[model samples]
Target: MKAVVLVRTRIVYAATAFAELVLWQVPKPVVGCTHRFKYRLAYVVDGTCVLRYDNEAGKGDHRHYAGKERAYGFSDPDKLIADFQADIARWNHENRHP
Candidate 1:
């Protein structure tokens, strides 16, 4: 079977901020991941990606935020999206103007 794209879209939050999401359902797991889904989610502001979640080859599942990288417990696609959105909210609350 071929890899199928499940989600590929961008969410515009402001003139200088947006979120990009790309998810694919693969025939098998990546080099390090255990699931069949591969995804990359990012939140950018002022031309800088400040938050991201992904499961790249040989890296398994992880997230990058505020110049820090950490392991992420990926449950499902819905939960992954929810967690990413929550992190975006937290980042904006701490860094962006109201």
Candidate 2:
């Protein structure tokens, strides 16, 4: 997976050919703007996504599985999306016709 920050805003883009999914997550300003922050989570499965903001209580928590390997992270939404796409691309390249 790959991630990049643009203009202080994190953007993640992902695509999975096997699953026929593409995802994009964009960061937004948190309300109240204290130490506590919130991120809008946008995920696309089979090219469609539902977005929900992470509450303070559930700020960063998620799991991803690639084949038999599992990865866990408390990461920003954008980063996660980018990583997902990169992994899918890499997997497709390695396992499928180019």
Candidate 3:
């Protein structure tokens, strides 16, 4: 089968912060991933992408935050979304002004 889009949406959190999520089910796993799903979930602030999760071609499941990259344990689509949202909340909370 061909690639099928599962989710493609942009969530606005504030005037300058928003999230873009795109998920697709491909015929096969990406080059390095073990699952058939390919996804990119990102949270942008101002005009910069400050947080992101992706299973890129050569990189298996991974996430980037605070300018650092790390491996991510991806179990399912539901868990992926949940983890991303949780991180977004953490980021916002840690960066909140007094």
Residue pairs in clash, model 2: 14-85
Q: Ten consecutive residues with minimal summed lDDT in candidate 1? A: 89-98
The weakest ten consecutive residues by lDDT in model 2 span 16-25
lDDT of each: 0.93, 0.38, 0.95
The residue ranges of model 3 lying beyond 4 angstroms of the native Cα positions read: none
Which is the winner by TM-score between candidate 2 and candidate 3? Answer: 3
What is candidate 2's lDDT per residue for 1-98, written digit by digit as tens?
Answer: 23223323333444421232222322443333322234333333345432222333333433333323232353554565566556545544665623
Deviation from native of the Cα of residue 93 in model 1, angstroms: 0.4
By lDDT, the better pick of 1 and 3 is: 3
Q: Estimate each model's TM-score.
A: 0.96, 0.35, 0.97
Q: Model 1, range 1-98, lDDT digits (tens) per residue?
A: 99999999999988899999999999999888889999999998999999999999999999999899999999899999999999988998999633
- Give candidate 1's whole-model lDDT: 0.93
Q: Which candidate number would show the highest lDDT if scored against the true structure?
A: 3
